[model samples]
Target: MSRDLFRQAAKERQTLFNAWLMLNNPLALELAGEAGWDCVTLDQQHGAGGNETLLACLTAAKAAGLPAIVRVANNDPGLVGRALDAGAQGIMCPLINNVEEAEAFVRAVKYPPRGLRSWGPYRAKIGYSGDYFTEANDFTIACPQVETKGALDQLDEILSLEGVDMVCFGPNDLSVALTGRLDIWAKEVQEAMTEVLKKAREKSVMTLIFCNDADFAKPRIEEGWDIVAVGTDAGWLSSAAEATRAAVSPGS
Candidate 1:
């Protein structure tokens, strides 16, 4: 965890923490890394700003010795390609529903021969590696998310996509897809998530869970989910702010 930036070295298991820097705060991202997280995913989907912010966040991750991953806005090959070129060690594509979509997602993250991502290893990734393009592809991780009812149904096939290194479960979106609820611990949503983990184990792929608490992460970890991201940077800040408000306001 301390040594490797990307958690790619682990074949059977690993734990990655999400930076979820929705506010594009580099200090928050640095704090997450310093707190001993394996890696941080820059939440591009449902996040503010654009590539400029992403570049700064990636720089912070590198400086902290934590690999930075980008959860891309969509499954757009061009966007995915640019994110990688910007020096993101990992790329997470959201709402992947089936093998075809998974295939396309993989294609966007990987370079030619393995994919059609076009050549741009000369970017941040290489710069950090001391101009080492010889083994750049091996270090890049491509994560395609399984977040909808449709995607859950095709979990096995989605996991089968070649260049995809991990499957991150978007619990909030998945809950809406399952029972139309966004609450963190919705029952139907939990059941659906368990099933997704079970199938992910069967396919021999790494699993990343999105949860707000360590308690919520237990079942997923027991189910062999490789990495669990507790919450977003925004949520952490909001929770802290609320706790401070309660402590100072009319307490018993």
Candidate 2:
């Protein structure tokens, strides 16, 4: 479980409260950590900015004692390797379908012998502790998000992979993929997501759920998800502002 952040959280703490960061700002990242979140997952796919922002936030995460994770849009080796080199403790790539994709994604995060990732920890060495090269192979986490129907089809094989540390279920994308519409609460999507949890449990793998808010996340965490990155920094900020404005404005 130590090698798997989600599992570690599930075992030590019931479930990890993660801030899904859509903003590239370091201050926001620091505040999330200060808010007592177990970790932060920087959203590179739908989030703003690029590699530069990732490096900056990863540094901030280190100072805040919050382990940083990056959610890549696709399974690109360069992106995966770069995130690791920049000191991300975990890498969550979306739309990973089948064993080959899972295997390739894992290889990009792992080092020599175990994987093909080049030897480079420009920020990892400084942010992470004690001989990174030796410990990285075991310390880094590989979490592939199961979103599409294709991924759901190959869930078992993906879970059984040697390098997969955890499995993340993306309800937003899966909702559309499963029902041809965006409704995370749709019966079809819910059933598919439930199947993912069931299979992961059977394989002894940890699971994470990408949720929009606490209400959505609560059920998943209770249903066996180890961690839930509920809502992005942008969503939280905007929602708070709207709520405050509504309370101050005239209402009956």
Candidate 3:
């Protein structure tokens, strides 16, 4: 299998950057991949696409030589297996509340004693690398999102689990779980984030976080996050449109 560039960067403590794809357009993903994002994640959890679109997006990423990660809508093993078989380089499962959930998420992405993923690398083999089954277990990445109060409570245990390559912080969901509001900067949320980052470092697990843009992510990188996902393709489109409108308008 091809080396997991993101994982390599994380090991070296380098700040790997990723682009978010919430839209179902393959062309947009292809463009984003070509634009040089270290990785591009397809947000199936909250995004508009399904299995078919995910396969297309993965194909597009491969064509641009970019690694593709899929944020699965749930922790279902079949769904996770399908994404891997379809050529996704990584799987990000959301709302993992404890070590058991984290273990299940890891099992779904890995093969054999390491995991329960059924054997089948259809497009993954042809598109990604050779000796698919042999090297896939080591090449694929499994990231469980730390987005709930329960997860934050057991952050260390979750990060210390075997086969878990990294953990992502979903500030929006975390804020809601803590204060019943979507304030990413809430004191409780920030504290939980700090704790997770510190524990991940102690355990030698990689850290990832979703930020609104580079500006929002800059400080977090300094705080020790290995990978940071910037703005979504949808957000970028809207921002560009708004900027163009402002530039052409003469008077308010």
Score residue 40 of candidate 3 by CA lDDT: 85
Query: Against the hidden true structure, what lDDT does model 3 obtain?
Result: 0.86
Residue pairs with backbone atoms closer than 3 Å in model 2 (clashes): none
Clashing pairs in 1: none
lDDT of 3 at 185: 84
TM-score of each: 0.88, 0.93, 0.95
lDDT of all predictions, in order shown? 0.75, 0.84, 0.86
Displacement of residue 84 (Cα, Å) in model 1 is 0.7
Best by TM-score: 3
Q: Over the stretch 121-156, how does candidate 2's per-residue lDDT look in tens digits?
A: 887877354678878877888999899888888888
Model 2: residue 114 alpha-carbon error in angstroms? 1.7
After the best TM-score superposition of candidate 1, give how far the Cα of residue 102 lies from its true spot, in angstroms.
1.3
Worst 10 residues of 2 by lDDT: 1-10
Candidate 1 lDDT tens digits, 96-202: 87788888888877777778877775455544534335454566778888788778888777777777677888888887887777875888777777776777667
Once fitted onto the true fold, the runs of candidate 1 whose alpha carbons sit more than 4 angstroms away are: 1-9, 127-134, 183-187, 250-252
